[model samples]
Target chain A: MENASVPSVDNIRFDGSARTRWRLGFDRVIGWLLPLLFLVAILPILSLVYYVSARALPTLSWTVLTSTSPYRTDALGVPIIGTFEVMLLATLLAVLFGLFGGIATAEFLSDRVAGWVRMSANLLVGTPSIIIGYFGYFTFVLYFGWGLSYIAGVFTLSFFMTPYVFRTADLAFTSVPRHIREAALGSGAKPSQYILKVGTPIAFPQILTGVFLAMAIGVGETAPIVLTTQPGVLVPQTVYSPVTFLTQLIWENFAQSQSSGLQVLAFQAAFLIMVVVIALNIVVRLISSRYRKRLEGLYA
Target chain B: MRWLRWVAALPALAPAAILIGILVALVGATSFTNFGWGFFGFHWDPPTDQWGIMVFLIGSFLTAVPALVFSMLIGIGIAVASATYLPGYLTRILDPFVDLLAGIPSVVYGIWAFVIVAPVFGSVLEPWLVMHVAFIPGFGPPTRTDGLGVLISIFILTLMALPITTLLIRDALRSVPRDLWESGLALGATRWEVVRRVAIPYGRRGIFSAAFLGFGRAFGETVAVAMVLGAATNLPKNVYDTGNTVAAQMFELLDSAIGGTGSPQILAALAEMALVLLGISLVVNVLGRRLIASLYTEQVQGL
Candidate 1:
């Protein structure tokens, strides 16, 4: 028994040490607290969702969704359409620029130049939205005399959003497998062909996600649009004409009256805008996650 | 074919070019000013030639500092709880909500603050604060609406800043090597102790950088802050008092400027404000980069 190689069961049994007990107690308390903390942290979102939905959901209807607010009586159709128009146009421009710039930054530029590009993008992203608004006013409205035009608004928004798209496209391009590029080049494919056929297709999902995010950003913007696009009741007759947007509707409505009817309409406008923005964000998340998973699968 | 690469680069370069052009124009606009101390004075009435920016400056700091402090404390807690203390399944559910919060537009947050939070503060929160802690500099007599004030701005800014701060800190905490956690557990350290003594210390650089970034975000945020803040151009007597901010005042400036009521001086003053905003953000970013640089020479993982 004394010379046995194997330990006895009792000797090998776990001990409830004081340190272990304290650690367990700590873990238990933390486990209980974690959910509570999360709830507190998420209070703003929950509150916004709750308040916006409860007040606004009832007000949204086919009537409100179909008619223009030429009389300013609470219809949201024109503003909603305008929002989509600006968002789509801005995102399209941003994505096109992003694709070209991202490819150039990632594939053609030197590392130092690429770093500069990234730094500038970060700086632009950090600049206040209002500052961008001011800049847009200074250039398009004042200097160029574009005078409250859709083209001006679109350009301002595209400038604001292109950085995100550029960064995403750059990242996507950078992440493309070296072998694929080498193989394409080795097979004597033209650089342009390789980029258009191989590089862009591989990175399309990420690039698209950036475009969606940019659209969300564009849809939500008030300051730039307010600065560049003069407010009008009618739909814009030309690219040079004034425009109105959903966010501006919300802003103008709330400021105009404390009346319950106006408040409801304002809330409704907010609600609709939120739905679109959140939907775009969800698409971004889904695409990025799917892309990540596919990458992981390929590597694994 | 080589020219094609440079041509492709132009799109990316355009934004940067535009940014530089804005700076150059701003500098040119402001070149006429004496660059005197009066420019930073309290008054901002352009017609009277009283075009100081001190009130807005103070208001900006007042709104941002508290929000930064609040977000940091709450954000650190959230990061710790979600990344280290909480179960994986819980994180899977909560993380998306946080991201959604981040994705909510600044305009929407403004609307929420204006319509929902402002009234709640006016009716419930402000009265309680005045009753309990009126002695504090930030607490004072409540206005009728109580929505357009520094406190409301702080509240909204804190909420707006939370997701970014939390995500950054979470990334920081997660960057710590697994072996450290294993070692801490092996040596009879509690999970909290491991996070407190090891994980936080190890990731302090990232956390500090995150703090600076979050502060920068609050500092430069527009629309939301402008909406909630009443944009009165005065030094705030208390948090409840309506205070002006640079971003908020920029809107007014633009309006007047666009109305053609503004002189070249007024336009230059607006330009100067823009430059100030650009300078502050630049400094904050540089400070953030320097913080990360001083800690380690390795590339900081995320922006």
Candidate 2:
């Protein structure tokens, strides 16, 4: 097999004087192929961005942004509101829980407990988002009788979001110098006060990045919403009423080959979602990269 | 203040507890269902109440396995290029775009597949494929499922897996010591030769973990697969045939199972399906984590 492609090392001169056709071919193939493949790999994503934006140009308007369409299916207003409501609620819960949960794991929990928390978080994060939705369906929808309500979606999204926040916060809190905590304690600050006054402020930037990342993830998530939120034509009356999402509109409406109008709405929704999701991710990468560099500078 | 100290742990603890409870509930819900070898048989007709998970299992793997292979090839290429071949400025721009791909929801991918890809395939690509490679198994005649089939599902999944696998593998490649490559190149080896001989061998574990992670994502993905896969409950005859994955089938079947038919048996069966998905994902995720941890340990030890 090796002989078919190229010569063995022993066959070649030890000096760099000789270069065979096979060797040159192998070098050129790899030299060109990897970069070309990388370009091909990103084509779909680039095309998605291009396609949605171009298609959305006709349907996007001030009217579309402000109010629901007269057709029940083509409306963007309610789904957009539902999307923000669920994301904001979930983010708030996730941040609150994640901050303390992370603090506890990094600062207060015993090694065994910390290990357990880390393991669980890892497992939960690894679990498919759909399963998380199914889990929400089982607990909140079935057991609690919430049916497809905002609270259920919020809880489920928060459940999914918490692990990410926890991991980021844990990393952030752990990076706080041990001496700072000691100094705070020695200054007669209580543990809570020390954590709040010293550790949290130090970790806030990184934690905020995590929160934003989670928000992006939750905002775009469709599975949990599919299972837990009531898929309705109307905007949600309250947190308890069933809500529509932009993703749901895209999924349910885009496949409608019958109506060009619904398809256009779906395309516009997709474009909007792409914008928001990409924006959040860029924010995350920017903040996190700068935060990492700052930490490196501090350590250095 | 003391109460607050303990309360801070609740948010983290609650999710962990919920995850565990979900697992237990899945088992408990499905415990009453009979899962003999026959249950794994490929007879999934819900009307007669004879539901076996084999078809969906095959569908999921049939799409996911090939998609994983495709993604690995592209992902490895991207990873290699990003770490070694690409200019730093290009890599900087490309990295965020790849992340943006990952961040985009699957539902959008589904819409893209249905709206843009399906028509394109039907009008142009599928006809060409059929003419050129009709003998091949996956390149057969396209069925009448609005052009949504396993092939499209595989394509969408490949796109979904690419960014995840690329990012993981790029990190793995980046972590390889510069000295290893320098030493190999110092021995009069070409850049490709140095990368193949030094960086890849050192980062093999991370690469494997990346593949596993991609596999995990592909296998359990829902919305995109649901929209593109045609949601048929039968075994696919070829890649062009309509098929349904476990998650897709569950999503479609759950409502009917819950409200329309309102049968406990079907609900239990759906629960069993969820259990299987849960189990496979958990195992794959744990393995991926282990591989990552091992690679980290190796790097720390200066290996």
Candidate 3:
């Protein structure tokens, strides 16, 4: 049998060994404590979802979700519609602004201009939604006298969400290989044609990912809406008219003292928003994973 | 070629112009009427048309600092453990959980804090602390509803910031080259030593940037703070005393301003918002620039 060549303990130097042992002990202690720490970190989140769902689920139904709040009762329909209307409008605005901004930053601009665009995008991303809400409240609602209209809310959310889309689109465009762009140009494509036909199509999935992310963020957003969009049950007769969405309906219902049917109905709106956010997150995951799988499949 | 480049650049200019406009408006508003030195002076009577932002400033700092510290400690520890010690399956499990936490709205977290965490802290941690170690001067007189104070706000804010901090630090740790680890291992160093001596040093700037991002998130957070924090517009005597942050106070006051109280109060609130927007923008920009520069430098050095 061959003898193993393991180093002898005596031959090993113990310089800084004590410090190492202390560190090892500290790490071991931390390792043991980590699961408990993670549990503590998770407790509030788990309990939140559990408690909100428990309070909201039994009350939530297709009727509550589909129908407006009961009349004079501070009920549901107007608010749900309001939420969707605002989100849809905001999403559209975000896509348009994002596409232009992303294209400009990635393809059209000099490096200095691109750098400035990137910085602004970062600042916008970092800026709180409430601040945007306040800006909307000040500029549109008060200064310009828009008066709590859908235009105010849509503009506010769009401004805030556009940065996200811009980041996504820019990344998407950048991810397209230089070789492809060159090849497109070599094939007699104009710059505009190259961007519109080649660049955008190649980056469509990523651009969609960005838009979806913005939408997901915009849909769940309560702060910006809290300031600009009128809260409570106000059903718009038309897109130009002011209307409360599901979130507003819920907030108003919860804010009131009297336990009217509409007030009771808010629990359902809250649940629906939560469900929508979770579902959107799932969709985001699915899209991303699918994109990754496609890439992997091609390579393999 | 230059004209084409300019054409391309035009699109990028739009966002920059928008951001610059916002900054200009904010600064212009703040600087209107001789730069509004009255904003800095101590005269906070709303009814009498006296305005001071001292309380809100104190409130913001008080809430944000503790939250930043607590979250950084816990987040760094978790990131380190996940990066170095955690098994693959556990890491994957934790990733989704982090994402879930990140995805949940701040308002929902506020509701959760109000409903669940408050009672637990009031019933459990407060009593235990009082019994065992609350004899200290700052720790006197534990109250029941004190759970909804600055401390609880900090706790909730910490949760909000944790996912970002964790993700950033984890990425930072992952960016540390394998050669460093291999060298350490060859030298017969333990994993803990290598992490403490090598990995953390390399990841320090990244970790700092992560913490700064957390600070920004905690500082600017309004809805959650508004919902759960008792919203008493006072300088908190103790960590357990009810208080309001700058953002929360702005939210509470914005509606009133809209309702047409007076010109001074509305202007004062506007000035406050402008100040906060400027402060946060400056800090975030500086930190972000530093982070990007550091990253670029690292990449260059690596190449």
**Highest-DockQ candidate:** 2
| Per-residue lDDT over A149-218 for candidate 1, one digit per residue giving the tens place of the 0 to 100 score | 8888888888788777777778778878999999998999887888889998888887787678777777
Q: Rank all candidate structures by their TM-score, best first, as comma-separated numbers.
A: 1, 2, 3
Clashing pairs in 2: none
Candidate 2 local Cα displacement, residue B12, angstroms: 4.2
**lDDT for every model?**
0.77, 0.77, 0.69
Q: Model 2 over residues B137-246: C-alpha lDDT tens digits? A: 66777555456788889889998888878877777887787677667766767667767888888988889988887899899998889888988878888767889999
Q: Report residue A39 deviation for candidate 3 (angstroms).
A: 2.5
Ranking by DockQ: 2, 1, 3
- Of 1 and 3, which scores higher on DockQ? 1
The regions of model 1 sitting more than 4 angstroms off are A1-27, B29-31, B140-145, B289-303
CA-only RMSD, every prediction: 5.6, 5.0, 5.3
Give the TM-score (vs. native) of candidate 1: 0.92
Task: State the lDDT at B284 in candidate 3.
Answer: 72
- Tens digit of lDDT per residue, candidate 3, span B194-279? 77899889878778887787788888888778766777756777667788877887776765565566375466456566566557
